[model samples]
Target chain A: MTDRPTIQRILTGISGFDDIAVGGLPASRSTLVSGTTGSGKTLFALEFLARGISGFDQPGVFITFDERPGDLRVNARSLGFDIARWEAEGRWMFVDASLEAGEQTPTVGTYDLGALTARIAHAVRQIGARRVSLDSLGSVFTRFADQDLVRRELYRLAGMLDSLEITSVITTERDADYNGVTRQGVEEFVFDNVVILRHVIRGERRHRTVEIVKFRGATHRTGEWLFTIDPEDGLVVIPVAFLAPRDRASSERVSTGNTELDAMVGGGVFRDAVVLLIGSHGGGKTLAALQFADAAYRAGERCLFHAFDETRGQLGRNAAGWGLDLDVMEASGLLRVAATYSEVASVEDHFLRIRRDIADFAPARLVIDGISALERRATPRTLLDFVIALGGVVREREITTLFTSAPTARGTSPIMEIAGITDVTLVLRHIEGPGTVRRAIAVMQTRGSAHDRAIREVAIDDTGMHVGDPYPGILRLLPDAPVPPSDREE
Target chain B: MEDQPPAALTPMATYAFRMYVAGRSRRSQAAEENLRALCDFYLPGCHEIEIVDATEQPALAEEERILATPIVIRKSPLPGYRVIGDLSDRSRAAFLLGLPDSGRPSPEGQRL
Candidate 1:
C-alpha cells in the first residue's frame, strides 16, 4: 500500500455519492459523462462546476458546444444556482461554441481546437480555475469524417488540460446500442474516468441510475447507483454502504406481540433480527405484524411502520377495528407511520426513504407492512438485492424489524429461500379443512435458537389476533392459496 | 472594430457582415481591408460591416459561432454564410459574401 501513489480527490459535494466514490472524484484528470438526451447530463456537469465554485472555492470554466452561455445562465438561475453572479465575481466562465441547426461553415483540411484552446487557456488564467467542463464535443466529431482525426484531436485537448492541471469533465451522448457507454467509444479511452447515466422507463415510471464504468488506478463501487436530480440538490448518488455488513449483533430477545406466537419462537425474536412474515391477501399478515409494532410502542419503545400497500388513514382505520389506535400512537410520537404506494417510487428511492425515516425517527422496532409490493415493482433479482440492502441498513442500527410479503401466484414463497439471512421466518397461509378453510401460522426458521415445528391455527377478531395449540390431525396445508376461480377452466 | 450602417437596408442589396478577429493582428487588418474593398467595389455603399475583436470579447466568438480567426458571417439577406481565413481572395470572398459577380465593373472587378 505504501508503494502505491497517493490519489488525491475532488469532492463533488453530492450527498451520499462521496461515500461510494470513497472520497469524491479523482483529481486533476478528465472524466467522461455519457448519457442520453434529457437524462440531466448538462445539468449534472453544470452543478459540478457550480458547487466547486460555491462550496469548494474552486474557480472553474464551462465550455459548452451545445447551449448558449446566456441560456445556460438562465437555466442555472431557475435551478437556484446564481451562475451569472459567479461569472461577475471572476469565479466562473462560460464559453459557448454551439453551432445553430442548418448553419454550415467551411472547414479546412486539418484543424484542431486552436481557437477553443486559446479561449479556455485565457479563462483558466483569468480565474485561476481548478475545474473545467466541456458540455459536449459530440457535434465537433461530425465536422470530421475520419475517426482517427477526432481521436488524435481529443488526445491533444486532453494533454492541454493536463498541463493546466485542471480537473476536466466532458459530456457526450450515448450511442443507440444502449450497451455502449459513449457515442464515439473513443472518449472512454482518452479519459481517466467514465460515468454512464441511464434513464429507464419501467411501468410508466422514469428511473435514473448511474454507474461508474471506469476509474483507472483506483477501486470504485461495482454496482450501478441510483441517482436523483432535485432542483436544489442536483445529482445525488445513493451510497453503496447500504449493502455493507454491520457488526451489530445482540442476544437480547423481544416479543412478537401475540402471546402464542412469541411462545412458538422460543420466547421472542432476538434484537437486530429481521423477521419476514410470508402470507397472501386476507391472511392477516399485516395485522399480526402491526400487533408487534403496537406492543413495542405500548412497552415505551419507538416503532416505525412503513405502509406500502395501504394509506395512513386506511391502516389506521383497519388497526382501529382491533382497538389499536395507530393515529393516537402516531400523535404520541411513539409510533411513526410512513405510507406510500409502491408504484409511486422506484425500488431504490423507496429504500432511501426507509433509511431516511430510520435515521430521523431512530426507532427501536419497525415494520414494513407489505414488502411484496416492492417485489412487484422491480425484477426478482433487483428485489432480492433491495431486500438484502434494507436488511443490512436496519440491522446496522439494531432495529428489530418485520417485513410482510405475499407468496407468488404459483404459491411459491420466494423469501423462504433466504431464511438464513433473516433471524425468524414465519409463514402464514390458508389450509383447507373438511369443507372449510382456516388460517394457520408456522415458524419456519429461527437463527441462534430452537423453534416449535408444529403449525398452529390462527384467528383474527375485532378484539385482536389469537393463536391456538398446534394441530395434531393430518394437515391439508398449502404454502399459499391457489388463484381465484374467476377465469378457471370449466 | 467598426460597424457601418447599410446604405439602403434593402431586402437584397442591404448586406450584413459580422467579422470575428483577434486584436490588431496583420490577419485581422487584412480581413477588414479586404472586406471593405470588396463591398466598396461589388455593392458599393450598400452593405453593413460589424467587426468583433475576439481577443477583447472572447464570448463573442461563441455567440457568433466563430471557430477560427479572421472569420466572416453574412448574417442578413435571408440565409447567411460563414468562411474561415482572412477574406483576401476576390472570388472566394465574393462567393462567401454571396455577392453576385454581375454587378457594375470596377478596378478590383478586373482581377476577379
Candidate 2:
C-alpha cells in the first residue's frame, strides 16, 4: 500500500473550459447543472454537446423544454453553433416542444410532464445520441400536484438517459443564492453529478459562477467559479489561482537563491506534505513556488510541478532568468511542468486531470502551484471535497504537496474555506512594521502539528522567499477578492 | 404640506392641473375648492388634472417640481410656456401658457 499515488481520469469535451475543469468532465454518468434564466445553462449544455461531437466524436442531441427547435437553432447559429447544420450532418439533433416545453401556456390547474419526458427519451433515441440535455425542468413540476411526481419523473428520466450511455447535463432554474441545499432534493440524489450555477452579487457587481455540488462516482472540486457567456466565445471561465495539487514540490530543499527565503520556509519546505504558500498579487507567490522547485532541482531531486494559472511555455519563458531550466527538467522527466488556463476547465475537470497526472507518475511530491484556478470550475463545497480528498492522498501516499495561494484585497474572502481546510495555511502579507512596510510570512494555522505563528518580513532578490524581522516601509499583504473586468463598468 | 393651485390653461397648451396638498391639510381643502371654482369659471375641456398629496404621492410632487405650500405648474403642450399660481384669473392663467381662455375647464378634457 506504500506504493505511488495514482491520478484519476475524467474527460469533458469542451475546450478552454476543460482546462479549468482540470483535464475534462469525468467519463460516463450524469451531472446536474442548476441555474436561473440566461445564466448560460443551455449554452453550457450546447457547448458540452458540441464538444462531445467535435472533440470526443460522440453523437449527441439537445432536447429543449423552453425554446422551439427553429429558435434554438437560430440562437445557436448566431454563436457559431449551427444546431441545424450539425443535425443535417448527423452529429446533433435539436428537439423543442414549444407548447408543452415553454411555460407560455398558463393554466389555473396542474399539467402533465409524462408526454414531455417520453418525448425527450424518444428524441434521445431518434438521433442515436450519446449525450442530451433536458434544457430545463422547472416547469416540469407545473403539472404534477404531488412533489413526488416531479421526483419520480426526474428519476426515470435520468435512468433512461443513463441506460443510453449518455453523459448529459440537466439544467434547472435555481435561486441566486446557492447554499449547497437543493430544491429538487430527490432529483439531485438520483443523478450521478450536480453542478450549481450561481449569480453572485459582490459589492455592487453581479458575477456568474458554476459549482459542482455532487459527483457520486468521482471526486470533484466544489467551488464557485467566475464564468461569463460571450456571444462569440460562448461560456468563458477564469479561475482564481491558489495552491495546486497533483504536482509535487522538490524536497531537496534548495536555498531560495535568496538566503533569507531558506529561513522563512524552515530550511525550505518538508518533503511529502501539503504546504500552502499564500500572498496577494505580486506578493511573490509564484516566485516562491518557483524558487522551491529550482532549489530542489539544483539539489539533484526530481521536481514535477504543474501551474494551472499559466501555460507551460509562458512559465518556462518567464522564469528562464533565475537559472530555472524548466525545458530541460521536462525532457528529463525530472520536472513535469504544465500551465493550464481556467477558462479551459471547470473544477471537476481540473481535479480529474490532476488526479490523472498523480496516478501516471506517482511522484514523491506533487504541487498544484495555485489552487485558485480550480475554484473557477467548481463550487466551494466540491472544491473542499476535492482538497480533502487530495490531502488524504498526500497523507496516505506520503507525496509532498506544495502550492501557492494569492489572496484578494477585499472584505469578502471567498477562498477562506479552502485555505482554512488545508493542512498548512501561511500568509505572505505586506504589513507595516516598525514604521516601515515590507513583505512578511505568518503561519496562520497548521493542523496536526505546530509551527511558527509570529509573522516576519520576507524579501526576494536574485533568489526567492527571503525571511527577516519586520521591515518598516513595505506594505502588508491584505486579503481581498479579485475583481472582474466587468466591474469597471459604471 | 399644502395643496397646489389649479395650473394655467390654454387651447394649444394643456390646462395641465395638479392638486398638490398635505395629508388632508387645511390649505389642501382651500386649494381644492379654489381649483373647482376656477375650473368651473373658465378653460373647459383642455386640462390634465392630477391630485397629489405629499403624505401619499410624494414622488409625483417632486417630479412636477412642487416645492412650496401651494404651487401649480401649468405647461404648454407645445413648447416651454408655464405658470405657477392660483388659477383665479381665467385670462392670466391662459396668458401664462400663451393662450386665450374661451371658457371654463372641461371635465372631459382631451388628452394630449
Candidate 3:
C-alpha cells in the first residue's frame, strides 16, 4: 500500500470557522463561497483576507468585482478592520476590477481575461501575498456575456493561484437560498472546495448558517452550523459541536444561596454544576435565582445575572422587596445585572450578547432568571439549542450556572430535552390547599449524589426563601395542572 | 509606425487611440493590425496609436481597469469610447467607436 501525502491547511483566523473546518482550508487551494443576496458573502470574503493579515501576519490580495475598493474599505472599517492601514503597510493589496460609473467596454470578438490575470499576479507579487479573496464571481459572469470563456479563464486563474502557492477564497452568488450551489453552474466545478452560506427566515427572524459542501482531498464537519455577523467583529461561525468535551468534574459543593434548600439538595450542588430551576409564575423561581446570585456575590465571586422578562429597575425593586440589596452588590463589583426584554433581539443575538458578557466579566457564577420569556420568540428546537450552546460555553470555563424556566401550557418543558446535560434539576410547584394556595419545592435529581426525595413546603417572606418540612402525600408536581388533594394533611 | 502628420492635417482633428493587450500574443498582433487598417482607410495620416502590453505595464492596465485583453480606447475627442476584444468586425467596431462613415470605402471593395 502506498501512503498518500497529507494535505496541509492554513488557518482562516475566522472565529469558530477553523474548528468546524477541522483545521482550516486546504492550503494553496481555491475555495468557492456561494450565497444568496444579503447572505454575507462579501463580508466572509473580506474577513478571510483581513484576518489573515491581522492575525497571521500573512499578506493578502483582495480582487473586488462587485464593490469598489473604497466602499469595501469603509465597510470593513465598521468591523474594526484597518484595511487602509494594512494597505499602507504593504500587507494588503486591492485589484480593482469593479466597473466605474459611466464606463462602457463593448466586446467585439474573441477575448480572454488575460489582463485581469496579469493584474492579479502583479498585485500578488508586489505584496508577497499568501492569501487572495475575489469577491462575488457573479459580477464577472454578468460583465462577460460569454459564460464558457469566463469559466475557462477563471479555472485557469485558479490554477495560476495554485502554482503561486496562495490560499484563495472566491465568492459567488446564488439566486435562491436553497437552490443549486451558484448562479453559474460551472463555478463549483472550477474550485476544489465549496462552502455555502445561507440566510433563511425562520419564525419571522433571520437565521444565518454555513455549510461545508466539499473539500477535495480533505476532511471537514458537514451539515449546517449557525453563524452571526457582528458589526464589530465581522463573521463568527457558531460551532456548537466543537466545544471541548469536559470531563473535569468538581466534587466541591456550592450553596444555592439558601442554606435550608442547600440541605435538601444533599449539602448543596456541585461547584461546576448546571442547575435548572423550573416553576410557574409567582412560584418563587426568580426569588431562587436572585438568591443564587446573592450567594455568589457574598462568597466573593463575581456573578452575571441576566433577566429577560424584567427591566433593571423592576429587578432591583423585586430584590429590594425580598430584603436583598442589588445596588450594593452592583457597586461592590461582584455582581453585574443585565436586563432586557426577550423580544428586543433574536435568540441567537441574545446568546451572543450573553456570551460577550461572560467573556468580559469572567464571572464565576451566571444566572439567567426567565429563559421562558425567550421561548416565545424562538421555536422549541432553537430554544433547546440555545441552552445547549450556552451550556457548552459555561462548562468549558467550569462556571457555576443556573437557568430558570416556566413549564409550557402543554405541561412539558423545552429544557426537558436537555435533561441529561443538567447536573441538578429543581422543580417548584403551587399547591392548592383548602381555600388557600401554598408553594412546594423538590430536589428532583442530583447527578452523582443522593438528594432529599421529599416534597417540602417553600415560603418567601421579606427575608427571602425558606425551605420547611415535607408537604404530606403530594404525588404530582405539575405547575399549571390541578394538584391532587393531599392524602395526609400537615 | 507613422511619423507626425503635416500641419494641415491638424485642422482635421487628430484621433488618438490607446490599445491595451496582453504581451505580444497572436490576438494582440491581430488587433493592432486591424486597428491600423481601419485608421489608414478612414482617418488616414491623422490618427495616433499606442500599443501597451499589459504584462509589461500592469500598472497602466490597473489604471485603465482593464479585464479582457486586446481592448482599444479612443482617448482623444470630447467623448471617449472603449471597445474590448480584437477588432475583427471593422464596421461594427467603427460604429461603436463613433467613427464618421463619410470617408469610408465601399464594403465590397474593402478586404480586411
Score every model by TM-score: 0.72, 0.42, 0.87
Backbone clashes in model 3, listed as residue pairs: none
Ranking 1 against 3 by lDDT, winner: 3
lDDT of residue B13 for candidate 1: 70
When summed lDDT is taken over every stretch of 10 residues in candidate 1 chain A, the lowest stretch is: A481-490
After TM-score superposition, the amount by which residue A131's alpha carbon in candidate 2 deviates from its true location, in angstroms, is 0.9
Q: Lowest lDDT 10-mer window, candidate 3 chain A? A: A481-490
Report the C-alpha lDDT of model 1 over A120-217, residue by residue, as the tens digit.
Answer: 77788889999998888676677546567666766777788878888888888886426775777767666789887788875555667777777788
- CA shift of B3, model 1, Å: 16
At residue A130, give the lDDT of candidate 2: 74
lDDT of 3 by residue, A206-260 (tens): 7898999988888888888788888776787765532445667788899999999
Each model's iRMS: 3.7, 27.3, 0.6
Evaluation by lDDT, superior candidate among 1 and 2: 1
Residue B83 shift from truth in candidate 1, angstroms: 3.3
lDDT of 2 by residue, B1-112 (tens): 1586545333444555655554565555555555555554554565666666554554454344332323444443444443333344434454444445433353455321
> What lDDT tens digits, residue by residue, belong to model 2 across residues A1-490?
1112242334555433454455555554667778766688878887888767766777787766566667777877876776677788888876554343322222111222333444455556666777777677664554335567566657776777777777777777765455544555455666667777777665344567777776655555556666566555567554422333435443544344345544545554455456777777667677767766765566665566778777877677657755567777677766677678865865545555665577777666666777766655554444455665566556556666776766522222445655665656677866655676667777666544455645677776654456777544444344654444244222
Clashing residue pairs found in predicted model 1: none
Best by lDDT: 3
